[model samples]
Target: MTLLLLLDDPAQPGVVELQSLTDDGLPEGSVSVAADDLASAVREREADRPRWVWDDTSRRYPPLLAAGVRVERCHDLRLCHAILRRSVYSQSSTLAGAPPGPWDGPREPPPVEGSLFDDVGPSVVADPLAELREQLAAVAGADEPGRLRLLLAAESTGALIAAEMQRDGMPWSVETHDALLVSLLGERPRSGRPPKLEALADEVRAALGQPSLNLDSQPDLLRGLRAAGCDVESTRTWEIKALEHPVRDPLLAYKKLSRLLSANGWAWMEAWVHDGRFRPDYVPGGVVTGRWATSGGGALQLPASIRAAVRADPGWKLVVADAAQLEPRVLAAMSGDTAMAAAGRKADLYQGVVDAGIVETRSEAKYAMLGAIYGATTGPSAVLMPRLTRAYPHAVALVEAGARAGERGDVVSTWLGRTSPRPDAAWQAEHAAASAEGAGADDVRAARRRGRDWGRFTRNFIVQGTAAEWALCWMASLRRRLLELDGRPHLVFFLHDEVMVHAPAEVADEVAVAMRSSAVEAGRLLFGATPVEFALNVAVVDSYDQAK
Candidate 1:
């Protein structure tokens, strides 16, 4: 059964309308419930295990979670609509050709005082039922309906997981965090930079022979560096590291400390951590390639120096797991490259490449494989590309094909049906001007450079996008498995290709098994019966830093 959940009416400020439907989305029955009774109504209906279809999971699920109610499955209409409205496979569907509507904007947060539909107007009245039917038609008429269906399901499941993870929050230790900060930064100051950071800035200024140089200002620092006999164009670490000068060490130290202090310093702990948990606002499908993005907290960019603060609660453990060589394994599976799959069979893919005599060392293999997916044109990656191509032609060919398609201003789809957006009008205009009669050499050069840059984006897009799909499937499977366990073993944090589950110590070992098996299931879901192995390094630890 499919339950279409929506606001009751614009006049009814705090009522909800629930319409029951068959699997094909045909209406069967309906009910209206007040906002105050929503949790009980939902809980009652959940006994049937119906897949709840709502406008946005973030807006609908969070309230129920707060009431201590959880659902087994849901279909997030907003997320599904986004997928169907742009997917190449659904080009002929009406939803794809329709003009932008209310479904296109950012999701609304759950109302704190009134009904979600109270502000609905004639122009903005987006009926969830109408959108649901259109999405169903689009997926039904898609070229690869099976793949599209899987992508939508995985994407919607991701939305639910994001909300649940936010509700549960990652276990955090504020005391450990403050101690680590003090140890590295020499005490949090009342109104300025910490002592160690200030001292490093002073050292940099003295070495550069500028007593009043503003270390915080890049332009001023770059001018000071140049005046001190250093020919550098930028303050990037790579550029500064190559120059030999007294200012080098001090400037690098200052920059590193500055980042640590600014990114996840004492101020961050006070704002994000609450009680014993760190809750980050996760934005699903936030990246164009389908990777998640944090709206405020630096969840994705958790620094290694302070990971020790991610301590498990009493009698609980953090089961951390991350896939090795994720992109390459994804490339192998999606392309159906049996040879590449064989290389990674029961072993590290990079090491497998070395054993296969493709490259002399593991580092070279790493560079070459990453170079292929990321479209590297120079340096060690370019040097090692030929050998890698010769060894794994099928895998190389897949990314190369995507690059060619992007250069032609065409869209490319991932293993599932998430398509890369077409180049904008400005990009088209640039290409047109370069191709005009008697075009300048400079114009042609600029056009070629821009084309290569976009090509690189599309080349990585296919692999990265598919890898993200795999991750969604992995988490979805693991989510179900964790619910089957005896204790409260729930996912609390997730970075791309890595996840941390907070579970009882007695169930930590079970969590490890679930993590491994779910990885296999994710692979099978994405690529059925493939030889590729999506191996994970599962570690049961007391703190995030303890994991490899």
Candidate 2:
């Protein structure tokens, strides 16, 4: 069963229009519900458990979630439209071939409810019925509609989760965060400069022998460091780490404190965390590789140093589950390499590779395998590459093919259906200019460099993109399982390969089992009968920091 709810405004009445969509994308009939009566209408239909279809899950679902209504399933048009438009599977479909118009850009969901874009009109976006028809046609005509459908469903579920997670909010301890900031950066200063940070800055200045040097300015700091006899090109963290100087430790300390203050210090806590929750706006399918990105509050890059601040409620526990070596396991399954799959069965993938006798040490195995997927053609990774190739030929060949395709400027598709973006017109012009008659050596070298860089991107794209799909399926399945378990355990935080669920202490064991089961289910859904095992290290702890 499916219901399509079109929202109007929140203050006045509830939803204005509702329809039941058939399998063929036609609305069997429309349901008329007054503004204030929408929740009851949804509640009445909840018995049927219809999968809701809406323009944007983020837009339409928040109102329902606010009204204490949670749907079992939904199809988010904003997310699906984005996926189908970029997918190679639907290249020949009507939606794919349609005029290059409105659908190119997504219908933006309101940042906060009832601010702007409350107008419901014909041109708001493509008509819901018409858009649905095109989407279904696109799916029906896809090369593998089943897989594309799975991808669409999983992607939509992710959108719903993003909204719900934001609304429900992640359990955060503002007090704990403030205390950690104080411990590391000293108390918030009257002049707004962290005291500890100022102390470190003084130390840096004394070490560099520049009494009046402005450490805040990159150019000034660089000059001062050079004057102190540390010859370095830039003040970048990686470059600074390699240089040994009297000011090195203090400089590093200053950087760490500066990042903490600028990125996630006292101001961040006051603005983002409220009522013991850190509710960042999450953008689903935000990354090119289909990873989620936070719009504000830097949720995706939550510092490990502040992990202690992410605490559960007094009686609840945070069940943290991170997929161990997710990408390598995905590669093993995609490449159909039994040897690699066998290696993946062990806890540490690099150690597993060492046990297989492919590399001399765990470090060698890690570097070599990463190099193969990421196109690292030189350095120690290249030196150890031959042994990895001999040990896992299939997996090695798979990424190599992707890289070759990229070098030729061909687009690559992930396991499910997300296609890589084509190179821009500038890239083509540069390559053409390089290959033209009497091209300069610099031009040829530049073109070759760009081509190789693009090759590396595509090489990682296939593996990273596929790994993202696996994660989507994992979360989607886990959400359903968590829903079944009395709604006590709810997904609260999600990083790329990790998820945190806030659950009651008594249900911790059940949540752990569900976490492992969801991993297997996700693998089965994506790779069906493959030998690869996606293992997760699950821990039920009071604070999220304790999990790792």
Candidate 3:
């Protein structure tokens, strides 16, 4: 029997009211109980393994997880509604046909200290049970309800993982982080800049022959560089490196130190790191391609130098697993390209292409394949594009079709169903203006530029979005597999194509096996009976720095 958890204030004043929902979202089986004691109610229901239907997983699951309660399944209405409404498969559904409502509002951040996942007022719902009915109708109306339902399930599971990872923060080491900073940029001084940064600034000033020039200021530095006749277009690292002047070295050093100081400096350490762990605000489905983005602390962009701080607790080990050549394998599976699938069987997909004699070197194969997917029209990649097309026609043609559709301003859906948004009004207007009679040269050029950009975005979107779906399934499967064990291994961190589990030393091997097994399961679930293999490189270490 499934339990429908309605978070309402009036339904049972200051408590959760549990109701039994029928397939059509009607009240059924008159055993409705007001769960004043939420954890116990949840614990009892968890043992029954009922699918808890709720509004938001991020809002509801954290408290249960924190209270040592776990559930087998959930139906996150908000997340499912979002997926269903935008999916091309559900275009004929009522939810997709109607105007956006409160459910469309930006998700509230998970409560920090307030009533944890508490019920909302009557006005907030606007009849939530009916809303669930509408969402179910949408799922039923989808062209491929099975795939869309699978997507929603995977997305909701991701929400649960995101919240749990936040609660159980990633293992971090302040001592090691501080030491790395000291080694690279010197000790944290009482005031002003670090010693290495200060020394670099001094060298830069001497080289520029301006003892007091403000290197921190971009305009002032550009003027100083111009005065010294150092051929620099901008303060970009690539631009600076091309210079032959002595300022290049110190300026590079200054930029590196500046980035470090600004992004992950002492202030950052104090703010982000707490109790030997870094808990980041993870926003799942934040990116258009379904990739997870972080709210703060640069969780998605942790620098390699700062990774020394990600140490496991004593007697614990970090099992890091990253999907190897994820996008290429996704392409092979989706395109049903046996040649491409065979090439991706090796650890290095590009090298395999080189061995197949499709390209001269691994680099050529890499650039060509990436360029094809990304809509490159010129340069090294474009030059090698024909060879790759001849070698792997289907994989190349798949992206080419996506690119063509994007150029025509048509929306394209991913493997499961997340659809690319149609061109906005402004974009359509601009494109129309370019098509109008007697359009200016500048207008035509601007329209062409926009076309290329959107084409590139759409070209990459399919593969990236499918890869994200695969990742969601991978992590969800791993979560279930890990939970099946005696609750020892815990997932502490997750990036796009990687996951790090904090487990006991004795279970490290088991975690590695689970990671690989989960990959196989995810692949099978997405593309059954396909020849493509979603390979992963697994590493077990005491610190995150040890993993690639």
Q: What are the per-residue Cα lDDT tens digits for candidate 1 across 456-501?
A: 9999999999999999999999999999999879999988899999
TM-score of decoy 3: 0.95
lDDT of 2 by residue, 1-548 (tens): 56564544333443366777788777678766674566667777878988777778766667667677777788887778878887899998877777766667755654354322233333346466677778889999999999999999999899889988887889999888989998998988878568888888889989887888898899999999888899899999988888887788889989988998888988888899989999898888898889999878998888889999999898788999999989888999999988999999898988999998888898898899888988898998999989888999999999999998887788898999998998899888888999999999999999988988998999999999999999999999999999878646898889999999999888888999999999999999999999888999999998878997
Candidate 3, superposed: residue stretches over 4 Å from native: 1-3, 11-13, 29-36, 118-124
Off by over 4 Å in 1: 110-125
- Cα error, candidate 2, residue 412 (Å): 0.4
Each model's lDDT: 0.89, 0.85, 0.85
**Once model 2 is optimally superposed onto the true structure by TM-score, how far is the C-alpha of residue 188 displaced, in angstroms?**
1.5
Candidate 3 lDDT at 257 equals 86
2 versus 3: better lDDT goes to:
3
lDDT of 3 at 130: 76
TM-score of 1: 0.97
Segments of candidate 2 deviating more than 4 angstroms: 3-15, 106-123
The ten-residue window of minimal lDDT in model 1 covers: 115-124
> Alpha-carbon error at 86 in model 3, in Å?
1.3
- True lDDT of residue 427, candidate 2: 87
Candidates 1 and 2: which is better by lDDT?
1
